[model samples]
Target: MEFNILNQSPVLNGHSVEQSLGHTTELAKLADRLGYKRYFVSEHHNMENVIGTSPEVLVTHLLNQTKNINVGAGGVMLSHHNPFHVAEQFQLISHLAPGRVNLGVGKAPGGTPLATAALQHELRSDIDSFNDRFLSLKSFVDGTHDNHKVLKISVDTESSKPDLFLLGGSLSSAKFAADNEVNYIFAHFIKNDENLLKEVASAYKELYPGGKFIAALSVLLTETEKEKKAAKEENSVYSLKFKDGRTLRVTTEKQVNDYIKNTDEKIEVEKSQLDMILGTKDEILSKLNELSNSCPIDEFMFHLPTADAALRNLTIETLAPIHTIHKEKAGIL
Candidate 1:
């Protein structure tokens, strides 16, 4: 029952700009009112289907409306943007939200390789430099470091760095996150191994010295049985796209089903390889509790596909109370 809530800023294809902005703002207000801890938007670019290319802009809009909910990138894909620019944007967010901001950084390129290359074409593509970039970003925001004297993130505050989290789905990322003292956010939706969650969490803790490990899950919660089943069916399709956006078509379920069935992979084997789940609330909560206890995460971020406001709201409404109770019992609330 004791955990933090992180709402995903998901995007859809059908909405107008006004509708998208309005829905996101509404979710932020609702999250604040519901006592959810933070709302994080993802960075996606050049995808005709996704609207979250500029999470900082979205964060600004949401912060204007919500009084309590912390808003920032559920992850800002560092691979695409300049570290300094990212820092400044988040610094501005921190200035606006103060103690209620977080900056979760992802090393993975969230878009197509072509798009990734295009985004980073001007910058060095040294993945190893992420560590340096992260350090530089922190220094810029924190206004610290003797060797490097840089402009403070335009905020002039010592604590403007905001809370930081290292996010990834691979074992390598878990190791790196642990090696560093930063918090770790395992994206379970992309790498959905429940056992791996426990393994990685333990590895992170062992190597971490101290700090929290956050597990993130992408889920859909439904009401009636019919609705639940329908949601599950729909979610399976959604999960396919989330996991692998390479599909040529979006409207065809047959393509997804065929892709799933024809893969040289067995169902269990493939499921283990994939990073998310599509199931009813009962099934979802069961797996989530397992990951929480097994991974012993300090917090859990729910990536509610933001396109469906109703389903997303229902997810938070139903799950927040349980998370709160669990947190209270565990003394984490």
Candidate 2:
């Protein structure tokens, strides 16, 4: 199976934003040298801990730092930006890295309602508008829009468009992605229902047989019981469903409490462990193999949830494609 990385650039306690971003750059470089297929960064805003606000900017920096690995947004939240501008930005990045660029888009706001409002202050960002925005972005990127006759996304005729990916976990999202004939990545870390994953995968595959279907999972490789216990605690996430159909996901109970205190809306709280593969290197690989056997996942992208730099690096090195191949050849896998 192919392996890719989805970095959140988490800023742990006492770690500066610069340090976190630098570590991300180093990890991307490591993944590139290790024969990983792609290294994508996430988009989050208004969060003190997780700070990957601008995926396009990070993608450009990572592309300049790495050689062969495909780099792009794990996603750019389409709800917060203009489709035309999004297409143009990624297309320009594609010119810099050619086939090594990817553009993953998602329907979520990627932040709190406050941040969303701030980001979309000048745009119509209703939830129902995501489909239209995505279609416009796709058309612009593919050079199929009728307006292309009068305007172009990129002035460079030789520039290649980035490969497009839609990030979602629901069956409806699967259908949408299939209908659009774009790559689909199921966010298993967010909602870890295996049967649902299978159904979504089957749905997408039946409709778009040739499209890529990836599963992004939260994972950490641990060496001791202490680390394993801590990793497990960090693997939990709280999902709050508000009365008005707004959902908020946070990692800590403190954040959940803060949200409840700040909002007057009634919410149903559901706390679940993130579907993370946590164990030694061998055990982790075994779980991945079992998951692959059960689900029709075309690629596996690891989302290291820990803020510990050493553990993150170790996880990346342990799961590197080259290292995995070496172990397989040695009959140690």
Clashes of each: 10, 0
Q: Which residue pairs collide in model 1, if any?
A: 1-323, 1-325, 1-326, 1-327, 2-326, 2-327, 189-275, 190-275, 191-275, 192-275
lDDT values of the candidates?
0.66, 0.86
Write candidate 2's Cα lDDT for 1-333 as tens digits.
Answer: 689999989995467988888998999999999989989998998776898999999999999999999998989998888889999999999998899999999877666656866887886435446788899999999888988877788887355779999998789888999999999999988887888988998889999999999999888998789988888887778898866454667888887786676556687889987777888888988988887888777899999888889888889988888889546757886
Cα lDDT for residue 17, candidate 2: 87
Candidate 2 RMSD computed on C-alpha atoms after optimal superposition onto the true structure:
2.2
Regions of model 2 farther than 4 Å from truth: 125-128, 157-159, 242-246, 260-266, 325-333
Model 2 Cα shift for residue 244 (angstroms): 7.0
Superposition error at 288 for model 1 (Å): 3.4
Query: Can you list the residue pairs that collide in candidate 2?
Result: none
Error of 2 at 97 (Å): 0.8
- Residue 262, candidate 1: Cα error in Å is 24
True-vs-predicted CA distance for residue 56, candidate 2, Å:
0.6
- Cα shift from native, residue 107, model 2 (Å): 1.2
